[model samples]
Target: MVLSMGIKVGITDTTFARVDMASVAVKKLNEMTSKVQIIRYTVPGMKDLPVACKKLIEEQGCEIVLALGMPGGKDKDKVCAHEASQGLMMAQLMTNKHIIEVFVHEDEAKDGKELDWLAKRRAVEHAENIYYMLFDQKYLEKQAGMGLREGFEDVGPAKR
Candidate 1:
């Protein structure tokens, strides 16, 4: 929907335990969309991210950072997942110029089966609340404008 609307989107998959295929998908999106920027991740270290993000800005001229927070497991993993997500948020906050957005999925059952419709609906509602907690229009607009200035020429209307 973002792409269709012409918004340049950059994706970061901070899925715990292992990187997922969505990272690859976002990279490919960079190729397909003139406005997209795909950032590479560096191993978490004391000073690596700040240095790496500087380079990403200097080299790729990236403006916004979106962090995807998929957990390694189910509810039992919430503590670790929350910590990881918080760490990423703190890092992004430290970077004064880049706007950060975090996406977190709802806890799933151990069996990893598809959620029933009601459960899915609740998850969607919860995710919406989470997004509100994490960001507001001012921040989003700043990120969107920065993205456009950086190289995301395709300006998309806000997603409904």
Candidate 2:
């Protein structure tokens, strides 16, 4: 449905969950149309993501995007875990130009409150805003320094 609307949709299944479900969905969609970009899942604390992403881009030429957020949990460690995940994702995005977007899913709000929806929406909006702010000037400079301007030219205009 999202793809039909011309959205370049991608799915992200964090380490806490299995990507098999999303994989099936992507496969079904691919059978219908070849428009979606299904980047592989990310595992928390896994050291191989950067290398994996690089290989994916080099081999498959796929643009990587990450989903950052926490799953529903009531443990004391939940907050810390969520923060850590977000931090790691931020670092990865900052250092990797191949990672062009981050979609944050607030699974903790699965109860489906209106406020929760609003908050989740706002979080994603803020993340996109920050990404664009950094992407336009700083990221371009880095790419320019590396003489890879053409490589990142397809990255669309930052959301206003």
List the candidates' TM-scores in order.
Answer: 0.41, 0.34
Q: Which portions of model 2 show Cα errors greater than 4 Å?
A: 1-12, 18-21, 24-33, 42-61, 68-70, 75-77, 95-160
Cα deviation in Å at residue 24, candidate 2? 6.9
Deviating ranges (above 4 Å) for candidate 1? 1-11, 14-21, 24-32, 42-61, 74-76, 98-106, 109-160
TM-score, model 2 to reference: 0.34
| Number of colliding residue pairs in each model | 0, 0
lDDT for each candidate structure: 0.41, 0.41
Candidate 1 backbone clash number: 0
Candidate 2 Cα deviation (angstroms), residue 105? 8.1
As a TM-score, model 1 comes out at 0.41
Which tens-of-lDDT digit does each residue in 1-160 have in candidate 2? 3335322333343464312233443454455445445555555622333444444555554444434333444454455555555554554565453343332233533454632444344334433433444334565455443422211124544455
